[model samples]
Target: MKIKPNKLRSISIVKGQLKNVKFCIGDDPIPTVSEQPVKSLGRWYNASLRDKDQVQQVRQDITNSLENINRTLLPGKLWRLQFGLLPRVMWPLTIYKLPITTVEKLERTMTSCMKKWLDIPRCLTNISLYGKGVLELPITSLTEEYKFSKIRLQMTLKDSRDQTISNAEQPIPSRPQPSSERDRKSPTYALCPTPATLKHILTGCKTSLTQGRYTWRYNQVLKSLAAALESERNSTNSLPLRATNSITAPTFIREGQKKPNHPPTKPETGQLAMARDWKMLVDIGQQLIFPPEIAATTLRPDLVLWSPSLKSVYITELTVP
Candidate 1:
C-alpha cells in the first residue's frame, strides 16, 4: 500500500501522561500531531479515551435540535417529537455509552418541551403524560426508548458471530426478589388475606374498594363519555339519518332473471329530528334511577337519555377492563 506521510496524524494515549509521538513512512518523518479530537464512524475519540466528550457533544446537539423544534410554528408538535426527535435521539443513545442520570436529564428536558407544546400545566405528573388514560394522547417516553435501545444492542452483541464476544462469559443480572416476610404481612394482606399479586392490588383489593379507587376511575371515564353524548343530544344539527332513497344492488341474479330497477324516492329523516326536547341523567354522585315509565326495572345504568315528545329512551352502561 502507498503511504501519504503528509496526510498522516499521530497521538499517543497513555495512563499517566500523553508522550510526544512521531510517525515515519520508510524513514520519512511525519510530524503532524492531532491535538484536537478525531471523528470516526459518527463517534468522537480524544486523547483522554473517555466517552465524556462524546456525551457532551450529543447533549449539545439534542438541545439545539429541541430549541429549533420549539421555535418552529407548526401543528402536531407531539407527532414531530415522536416521529422526528425521538428517532434522532435514540440513534446516539444506542451507539454511545451514556449514564442513566444523563438519560433522565434529557428526558426531563423533553418532557418540559412536550408540556409547553401541549399547553398543559407544568405540575402534571409524568405518569399522566405517558399513561393510557380515558383521554390518552400519543406520546413517547425517551427514557423508555433509551432502555429498549440498550437491551436491543445487548442482544445484538450477544448473538454476534465474533468468537471472542460469543464465547466470553457475560454476567446476566436478575430482578430483585420479593421478601417473604414483607409478602406475608403486606398492607393488602391485612385487608383481603390473599397473596399480594398484581390482579388483587388493581381489582380485588378490599382496601382499594373501600377507598373508592375503582369507583373514582369508573366515574372519570363515565363523565367524559356522558359529556360528549350530552353535547350531541343538545346539538342544533339534525341527527344522522340512514339513506332510504338509494337501493343496494343485489349480490346474485338468476340465469333467466334480470336485475330490478327501483325509482328513487325522497330520503326519510329520523323520527327524533322533529323532537327537540331531550333530557339526560348521569350516574355520578347519586345512583341512576331508570325512568319507571320507560322501563320498570331495578337496574341502575351509567347514563340515561330520554325524549318525552318522541317517547324514546337511550340507556348507556360503561365498563372498564
Candidate 2:
C-alpha cells in the first residue's frame, strides 16, 4: 500500500521533539506530525507509551458498565463483573503498573456497584457484625477480588508448567531496594479496607448500617429538642434563667401568656415541656440501666441515675436557647 504524506504521524516517547527525524521510502522522506493518545489495535497509545490513557479509558468504561448494568439480574451482574469486566481490566493492568490511588478508586467503585447489585449497604458485607445467613456471599472491594484472581491465575499457570527447567528458563525479577545508606523502611501489609470473607462481609455491613442509623436517630432527637425549646419559648415566654445567667428574669413578661404575679407564681408550659422531654430521655436511660450521672455540685441536675452495666457515662445539660 502506498502511503501519502498526510497519512503519516509520529509520537516521541522522550521529552524533546523528534526533530530532523523522518521515515523514508527510497530517499523520499515522509512528513510527520505529533499527536497524543493515538488509538490502534483496540487500545490507546500515548507519547510516553505508558498506557495511562488506555488505563483511564478502561476505568471510564468500567464506570459506564456499572451505571448501565441490569439491576434486576443480580447474579448476572455479579458474573459479568467477575468474569467479563475483570478480564478487561486485567489486560491493561498486565502492561501498566497502575497507581495505588487509581486502583483504590476503582476498587471502591466496584464495591459500590456490588453492594447495589446485592441490594444491601456497605455495612452488611461484614457478616460477623450482624450474624450469619444475611447475605448469600461476602462482598469484597474490587482490589481484593483482583488480587485473589491474580493469585489464582498465577497458581493455574504454575501448575500447568514443567517444574524442572521452568526456573532456569525465566529469571525471577528481584525486588528493588532503596539506594540510600540509611535503614530501609520495612514494608507494611494490611487487609483490604472492606472485609474479604463472606461471613465477615455480611456482619460488617450490618454493623456499619446499624451504627449509621443510630447516629442519624440521635441527631434527629437533638434537633427535635432544639425545636421544642424554640416553640415552647414563644408559647409560654416565662421560663426563668438563673439570676447570674441572664437579663434578670424578664422584667414584665415580654410577650405571650400573661403571668398573674410579679414574683413568678406559676411555671410556664414551655419550661414544663422542656423538663418533660429531658425526663423522657432520662427514663429511657434508666430502663436500659445507663442513666445519666449527675454531679454533686450546687445548682446541678434535678434527676440523676447511674448504671454499672455500661462503662460509659453520659451527662445532660438543659438550657432554654
Candidate 3:
C-alpha cells in the first residue's frame, strides 16, 4: 500500500530484508523480527579528507563510530532516529564525501524507482561527498521513499563482488533487490515537496512552489558553511560538526524549532511557527557562506557585498516596495 502522506509513516530497512519490513502510525508497532532498524543518521562521512588516502585514514579514525550505528541498529536507537526522539544522536551522521556525479546518479536511481518525483531531502542522499565528492544526501523530510533503497544501497557496497567498495561506487549506492522486486509504494502526499523540486530548492535556483526568485539563495548559506568548515579545519578547530545527514537549515529544521542560537528567551510560539512556515516557502543550501550582516534576515536580499581588506560582509535586504 502507498504510504499515507498525512498519516505517512517512515520505515528503516536493512539490506536483503526489504520484504520483511513494515511501518505503522507514529513510531509505534515495532517492525518485524526479519527487519533491522534504520540508524538515526545517514552513514557518517569524514569531513576533512580530500583524497582516497585521506578517506582511508578517516575510516580508521572513526572505527569506533560504528559502535553508535551498531547500537542504533539495536531497535531502540533505530526508533530514536526514525522519530527523532533523541536529536543529539542524529549528529555524527552526515554526508562524509560524495561526488556530485554520484549524487546525480543517486537522484536518478531514487526517482526512477519511486516512479515519480519525491522531494528526497539532501540529507537523505549521497551528500557526504562534499569532502571529496561533490554532493551529499540531505537530512530533511524532503525524502519519503517507498522503501529504504539507500540503506540497502550502502549494504550492497559492503557485499561488493570483490569486497573492495569503489570510491566512485562508495557514494553511488547499489540496489541488491531483484529488478522485478517492486515493493508497494507508500501513500504519496502532495502537501510536501518532491525530489524534483528539492533538486532546485537546495541549489541556488528556483522552484515550482515558490515565486521568490532565486529561491535557492540559501545555497550561499551552504557555501558559507563549507568555507567555515574549511577554515575551522585549517585553524585546528575545536570538535568538528556533523549533521544527521550532510546538515543544513531553513525549512528543513524541525517545524517550530529555531536554528541553533542562544536567544535571550525562547522564541514565542507564534514567531517560531511563522519562521517554520516561511522556511518551506523557499529553499537554499541548509548551509552556505554569506556575510554576517546578511545572515540575520528572513527575507531574501537583493545584493551581497564583501571587503577582504576590512574583513566584512554586508547584505542588503532588498525593499520590493
Candidate 4:
C-alpha cells in the first residue's frame, strides 16, 4: 500500500531512541518524525505504549469539563458526574494502569467542585461533613466504584458468551464453602463490633424510625434518646444498664454510611482545647467523659459528667455552629 507524507508518523518506544535512522518509502526518505501520541480507533496511544499519557489526557479533559460546569446546579452536577464523567473514565480506568495519585487528583477536583456547588464553606473539614449526613467519599471510594464497574461489565460479557453454549453439557464443580473452617476460627475473621458496624445498625434503625408513628427529625430523636439515657443514669446513680458491658461488645467490620446531618465545623485544634477545658472545670468527685458511647451503639454524647454527690450522669452535645 502506498502511504502519503501526511498519513505517516513515526515514534520510538525505547529509551534513548537511536539517532540517524532513516526510512524510505519507494526510495523517498520519510524525514518527518514525532513523539506525540496519535489517536486511532477512538483511543489515544503514546509512543511508549504506556497508559500514562492516556491517563494524563483523560484527567485534563475531565478537569476542563468540570471547570465549565456551573455551581448553581443543585444535585444536577453530581448526577452528571456519576453518570457522565464516571462512564467516560471507566474505559480508561480498565484499560490503563492508573496510579492512585492520578485517581486522587481527579477526586480532589470533583470534591472541590462539589463543595462549591453545595455552597459549603472552605473552613469545613471532611470529618465534619461525615458527622452530619453528608457523604464524604474518599478518592479510594471512587476507584473502588470504577473497579466494580469493570467487574460488572466483564461478568455481563461472560454471561452473554456462556448463554451461547448453555446447551452443551458442562461438568458442575464440587461445592466447597468459600471460607475455610480455620478462617472462621481466626481472630481476624471473628465478627467484632466496631464504631462503623454500630453506625450501620443505627442508620438502618433511623430509616425505620423516620417512617414509624413518631414523626420526629433524626437529630431530635438523637437528642431525646440521649436525654432519656442520661435521666436513667441519674436515677440509678451509676452507668445506665444499657451501657454496661458496652466496652467489650463483639467486633465486626464497619461499612460507610450516610450521616443524617452535616457535622459542626469543629477543627481538631478546637476539639483539643475543649478537652483541656473540660479537664479543668470538673470537681474532684466528678468524672467527665468525652464522646460516651451508648449501649455499645455508635451514638455518642460529646460530653458526659458523672457526679458522685448527685449520683447522676449528665450528657452534653456541644455545638459551635
Who wins the lDDT comparison? 1
TM-scores, each model vs. reference: 0.47, 0.36, 0.14, 0.37
Report lDDT (CA) for all predictions: 0.77, 0.51, 0.36, 0.53
- Expressed as tens digits, the lDDT of each residue in 181-288 for candidate 4 is 776543233232332233343343444454442223434554565566545444444322233235765645457855457567643331222221122112112333
lDDT of 2 by residue, 1-321 (tens): 776644555643335544536667666655544342455655565555566666787788888877767544455887787777776777565445567678878877777677776687777543432234655453335566556666665666667566763333343232245454342332111122442344443334454454453244555565576466446534433543323334645557657867666575564332233322232233222232333253333333322323232232334553432
Sort the candidates on TM-score, descending order: 1, 4, 2, 3
Give the Cα-based TM-score of candidate 1 against the true structure. Answer: 0.47
- Overlapping backbone residue pairs in candidate 3 total 51
Best by TM-score: 1
Compared with the true structure, the alpha-carbon lDDT of candidate 1 equals: 0.77
RMSD to true structure for each model, in Å: 27.0, 17.6, 27.9, 23.0
Off-target runs (Cα >4 Å) in candidate 2 are 1-22, 26-44, 70-75, 126-141, 148-321
What is candidate 1's CA lDDT for residue 63?
91
User: How far in Å is the alpha carbon of 67 misplaced in model 1?
Assistant: 0.8
Give stretches of model 3 more than 4 Å off: 1-67, 71-75, 80-97, 100-321
Each prediction's total of clashing residue pairs, residues at least 3 apart in sequence or on different chains, is: 0, 22, 51, 13
Error of 2 at 220 (Å): 61
Q: What is the lDDT of residue 274 in candidate 1?
A: 50
Model 3, residue 89: distance off in Å is 10
